[model samples]
Target chain A: MTIRTTLSAGLAAMSLTATLGASTALADPVTVGLITTLSGGGAGLGVDIRDGFQLALSMSGSDAIHLVVEDDAQRPEQAVQIADRMIQSERAQILTGIVWSNLAMAVVPSATAQDVIYVSPNAGPSQLAGAGCTPNYFNAAYQNDTMHEASGAYANVLGYENTFIMAPNYPAGIDALTGFKRYFEGSLAGELFTQLGQTDFAAEIAQIRASGADSIFIFEPGGMGISFMRQYAQSGIDLPIISAAFSFSQDVLPAVGDSALGVINTAEWSPDMDNAANQAFVAGFQEAYGRLPSVYAAQAFDSANLILSALAAADINDLPAFRTAMRAADFDSVRGAFRFGNNQHPIQNYYAREVVSVDGVLTNRMVGTAFEDHQDVYATDCAME
Target chain B: MTAALFLEQVLNGLQLGLMLFLMSAGLTLVFGVMGLINLAHGSLYMIGAFFCAAAAAASGNFWLGLIAGTAAAAAAGALIEVTVLRRLYDRDHLDQVLATFALILVLSELTKIGFGPFPLFLDVPPILSGTVNLGIAHYPLYRLALIGFGLAVALGLWLLIARTRLGIRIRAGENDREMIAALGVNIRALYTLVFALGAGLAGLAGALVGAVQSVQVGMGEPVLILAFVVIVIGGIGSIKGAMVGALMVGVIDTMGRFLLPRLFGHFMEQSQAAGIGAALASMLIYVLMAAVLVIRPKGLFPAHA
Candidate 1:
């Protein structure tokens, strides 16, 4: 009776191992946690990122990846809490989709420390790219300063000498101005640091007028940009404005109305980019969400495809192999020709796009290239162990 | 700064002050008459902007949108007074605060659901689209119109409060609610009327500002904080105090933002000075409020005293 029982137990164990081996041969499931701002002033950006990522995921038709999403409401503390819950309870091995730089600063360090992979779709604060860089972290978006640097480079191209510059007083805001000044060859007419979340720009506009600047370079994003553009238009101080795409992106151009027309802005991706991958992304995104995708959405789509490409090559359980796959970044990016630098941030092209009315719908068209194969200045500072 | 620049800054200050008065007037009136701290005043302001944007898009007339917004806010005020605020009159301030805070959440979510998460476009009317020659500076005609509208509303409010029979009952209720009830006056209806009137004024301010600023969710709370400061400085429940306090706060805030950075620039690098100046300027209004509170604990124009 004992010999018969041992033989039956061995048979059952063999069947269980066979089933596990077959499953491994087929595909290994990956859980991804997406924490983004979904219910506040910044909700528009988050919604675009979420819809873009979901569109990429659904198009891939790979049931191997499971996604869990939560709203951070644009708060750092809330983002931290969500990251904790996703890591511990949901067991999300991969995390992505943070919109604001401040919130990313709060969540990314500890998350990477816990051995979880964080592929940033947006919000690449300079700290993560420099000495604080981690091995497991990858930035699918440009560093925070890179877009602003593009504007600075384009400003030189446009011969904007004695330009008046303004930004809100915060870490990212400071980075924006610093980045612009790094590449700008001309002297500044005026530099003003306005209060964050300031809606009224009348005082600043008056200062700009009195500054005798030839052009204006502002970095006010979201609704602040809408307010500034409207007020600036009414003030009749049209000195040819240039800014990063954060202010002039598709998500905000509609609210900005005719005032945004002909404005030159710098970005890594535009809807009018002439590439098969980009055209497909723009068409698929609009058909799926009924609105043009912003640069944030394009970045998020790339981040998801990046993950999928890595997953297809290596199992998530094999951490070293998966990291190597992600580093390779073997995927067709909507922005075209995307790859990671030594710091794991994207080294790509930045273009200057002009806001134009396309069939009465406001969108951007590529006008010029700002930077070719641009890498972040801080890449040399990253001592990745 | 040049004289033209200074004049432009002053006009900017006046415009900001007048808008604050419109917001503070309603807040003060409700507090004085009902003895209820209505924290949801900002939510009403948001509702006004949303309704105005929607109505303006449908009608293509800013005037129609303005009327629709004002009426909607008044109606919302009346409904809220009858349903939720009536029971809270005798309750503690904490309970009133909690309930009204909840209303903010509910109203904000409902607005988001109705308007989606994006800001709506609302441009200045054609007649008020260009700049006006103000001798020293060319100012936006819509802003000058806003100043004129705000002043007209102030005058109208003063006449209504000082001359009308309804105003007499409102003053009486503020002094002695029990006495007004004993004098065969319908206190419940008066409360609703005052609340609705206050709400209408707030709505008007919101609709006007929405054309200049982005018409989006959570726009009201920042303005609401400044309104509270204005009332506290002017003395709660006093419309005259609200007017004086609003103007002072607005001018100080605008001037602080304009001058503080330049002041620091004389001693420090321009960029460093500008940063420090802006940091201090944001604190200027709160500093002014604290100073006022220290000197006049009851406020500049306390209704009771």
Candidate 2:
């Protein structure tokens, strides 16, 4: 009787454990945790990267990345919470997608500490581009200061005497101002750093109106840009409102409508760039979402391109090689040329652009070159020997 | 600065104040009556704006879309109250916060799934497209109309609460829900009505502001927080207080942003003055809020049933 009972217990244990584990292990897909600001003011950018990443993944015909999505809600604490769950509980092998620098900073350190690789589709903060740069961290987008520095250089070429500089007050805002000052050596009529995500700019506009500046350079992106531009136009300030890449996002232009026309911005790429890559990307994006792709979307696409190349180079079956290959910056980006700076930040050209209304469709088109081989200034200060 | 410039800035303040009133009213009322701190309130505002834009573009009539947007928000508010919020009413505030926070996630993703994450604009009607003269100041006619419309709403809400049986029930509920329920009132129905009313107000606010601003996802959130700040300063659960608080907050925020830096310029460098003043001005509302909290924890004009 004892022998028979032991045999039954052994059979039951096998039934409950070994066979089940074998089947489950081979069937479940490798999950990638895509953390983003899927809600709040940053939702537009989150969705852009979402669509672009999804499209690029589909085009690659690889089932290697099974996304376990979490919306950070544009909160730093929530992003860390989501990252913890994704890493330990959801068992997401790789992490990607963050639109804001503050949030990326919150999540990346945690992910890196766990020895998990994080791929940033956008938001390469200078600190990340410099000293805090990690081997496990690779960014597929432009560094935060690169484009703004380019804008400042172009404003210098335009030869404006009295210029005004404005940015949302934060680390990135300060970075933008620092970057702008690196290239723009002219006298600043006034420097106004306002609160982040401020919807109304009446007070700031009042300040600008009184500054008596010849040119106005600003770094308010997404919905904030629309609010500022609309209010600026209505105030009849009559100065050129310059911007970083964000003023011309697919998220902002529609809000301003005709008010956005003639606004000059600076970026590496625009939908109306008239390049083969730009035209193709714009066409594909419009066909899918029925709207032009913003710079964020373009970066997302570039991220996918880089990721795919890295995956192929590493031979996905080998995770170590995949990490090694990603460290190498495998593919050429959509922006004509790109190379990883010593700190792994991107070195790329920047273009000055204008929003034009052609046949009722409004988008930014490249008007002039701003800076070439433009490196973020803080890279020189980085002690990443 | 010239008087004309100052006059123009004042006009801009009024425009901003009116927009704040639209958002703050519903929020103040929701807090006052329902006694629930809802973070997802902004998501409902976004839903209204999105529906207004889509419907207006489809039907080619802005007015009809505005109506639909109101109804849709009412329906959504009722639905959320019934399905999710009802369960949370008796729970801890933290539970309600967490659950509603989750609701924001659901609503935002659903919006992306439905509207595909693109920002849209609602056009000002042709009749109100141009600027109108106001004491040597040119104002956008649409903006003026918004102020008129907000005043009408304030008046309408006043009459609805003061002159109607529903208002009595709401007041009664705010005073003592158990008493109202024991007195044979259909408390569930009353809650539904209040929730729907608050939601409709929020929707109307979103749609109205949609004309001047972009109708985009999550657009309602920043304004929603400010509205809470408004009610807190004015006194919770009082419509009159909401109106007063909103206008006060708006006017102070606008005027301080404009005037404070100049005031500082007398002693400091122009750039230093602007910087110091701008930083201080941003905090002025919070400072006012803290002072209010010190004086009246319940609010400035606490509602007595």
Candidate 2: lDDT of A101?
Answer: 91
Each candidate's clash count: 0, 1
**Model 1 deviation from the true structure expressed as Cα RMSD, one decimal place:** 2.8
Q: Which ten residues in a row have the lowest lDDT in candidate 1 chain B?
A: B104-113
Could you give me the TM-score of model 1 versus the true structure? 0.96
True contacts kept of 1: 0.66
Best by lDDT: 1
What digit string (tens of lDDT, one per residue) describes model 2 on residues A1-385? 6999999999999888988985775565556788887765578888888877776777667765687778888899999999999989987767888898999998998798787878888888877877787777777777888878888888887787788998876678777877888789789888877777787776677667777899998988777777677656655557876778787766677767887788778888777665665566677887888777778888887777777777666654466687778767766566767666766667778898898887787878789899888777666766653
lDDT of 1 by residue, A91-194 (tens): 89999999998899999999999999999999999999999899899999999999999999999999998999999998888899999999998889989888
Q: lDDT for model 1, on a 0 to 1 scale?
A: 0.92
DockQ of 2: 0.37
For each candidate, the DockQ is 0.76, 0.37
